[model samples]
Target: RWSEIDIDNAMWTIPAEREPLPGVKFSHRGSKMRTPHLVPLSKQAVAILTELQTWAGENGLIFTGAHDPRRPISENTVNKALRVMGYDTTQEVCGHGFRAMACSALIESGLWSRDAVERQMSHQERNGVRAAYIHKAEHLEERRLMLQWWADFLDANREKFISPFEYAKINNPLK
Candidate 1:
């Protein structure tokens, strides 16, 4: 289950994925969604979510488990989808790796501080507050942007043959 939740303007109805967190809802995948999961969405993430909206087909849950329907997707299923999508899941490219992927994106973007980055990753907030006591899902915009960027990067690089390190120069310069 997600560690926190926040309701903004009361417009975004983050469901009660877990109890006591009204605005923050856990992904349909539940506990498997990863902790400190405030990873910002790159452009690629936006596109994927937008694309995924269609697959949702008016369903409430975005990522539902197969054969269960009631529970959220598992990390295994997510990685399996990646494997089918051509990623080498066996090479440490599992679903949990998305945190690193997204964090790398944020650092490359130069739009996030370490604290913000950690908060976004849901690793732990940049602030001194413990993740358990912290209830605010900050950096929604940054996460959105981060995911979008990641999505865009993926889309752009899907056809390439270079390693991510090779692509990093094109996407972001090293200091």
Candidate 2:
């Protein structure tokens, strides 16, 4: 929803519960952890969202269903789209696979801390004691930088593909 996005600040806050809007039928029970997740948007993300705002309806949904303007897209929508694009969703890649692919790439890059990347992925520590100790560490600044780098890396390799390790060797931002 538009209410969750702060375009000016380059931030997207995924609330724990959906903020009810008049006339909207669906209520999204936010993240899996039942906690608000702050995602730092990259420049590319902000640009894409700015363009999407032009198509946003009165209900403030960024991506609504084709059949019903008031409702968000169904869970299978993305997978269907991917299948149409010639990908075998079952064998090749599904919607959720993108998350795993990105997480793997981010870890392979070796530029970001594990904590920052996991937090960015909205993953909570499974260990109760560890979760308690590190609960306050948002790592927002590091995540912001990491996300921007990830965007840049993707943009740079969009036309000519290279492995993350090879790309890091050539264009290590820290170096």
Candidate 3:
């Protein structure tokens, strides 16, 4: 929602508890982990949001349904778009596949730490004992740099494709 976006700071805070819209019945709306997720936006993301702000309605939603302005877009929206673009949603790629693809790409790049990537992905530790032992580190600064790198990588490969391994080898700032 627009309320979550902090364009000036290039951040988006996904709240742990969100009040329902008027006439809606949901008690809470938030991340699956029920923890606030901080997303460090890249310059490209901020630019897109800046453009979107011009048409933002009083409902405070960034992306609303075509039929109902107060509600979110349908879950099938991205899948439908992929179908229009000649992708087989069943076999090739679905909307959720993007997350897997991103996760895989980031890991393959070897430029970011595992902690930073997992934090950015909002993945909670699956092992109960491990979760108890692990520290709750946000890794905000590293994520900020990583996300910017990701954005630049995407922009660089918009036309000509480059493998994550090759790109990382050339652009690894940690070196």
- Superposition TM-score, candidate 1 onto the true structure: 0.52
Enumerate residue pairs that collide in model 3.
none
lDDT minimum window of 10 residues, candidate 3: 20-29
Candidate 3 C-alpha lDDT tens digits along 52-142? 9999898888988899998877778999999999999999999999888877888899888888888889998788887777648889998
- TM per candidate: 0.52, 0.92, 0.91
- 2 versus 3: better TM-score goes to: 2
Tens digits of per-residue lDDT, candidate 1, 41-156, equal: 34434455667666763334566667654455665888788888999987968887877876776676564555556655446444565655655657566555444545656776
Q: Report how far off residue 145 is in candidate 2 (Å).
A: 1.0
Alpha carbon lDDT of each predicted model: 0.53, 0.87, 0.87
lDDT per residue for candidate 2 within 1-175, as digits (tens), equals 8888999999999998887645555465787677999999999999999999988999778888899887777778999999999999999999999889878888898888899999999999999999999988999998998888888889978889887777777766666
Worst 10 residues of 2 by lDDT: 19-28
Clashing pairs in 2: none
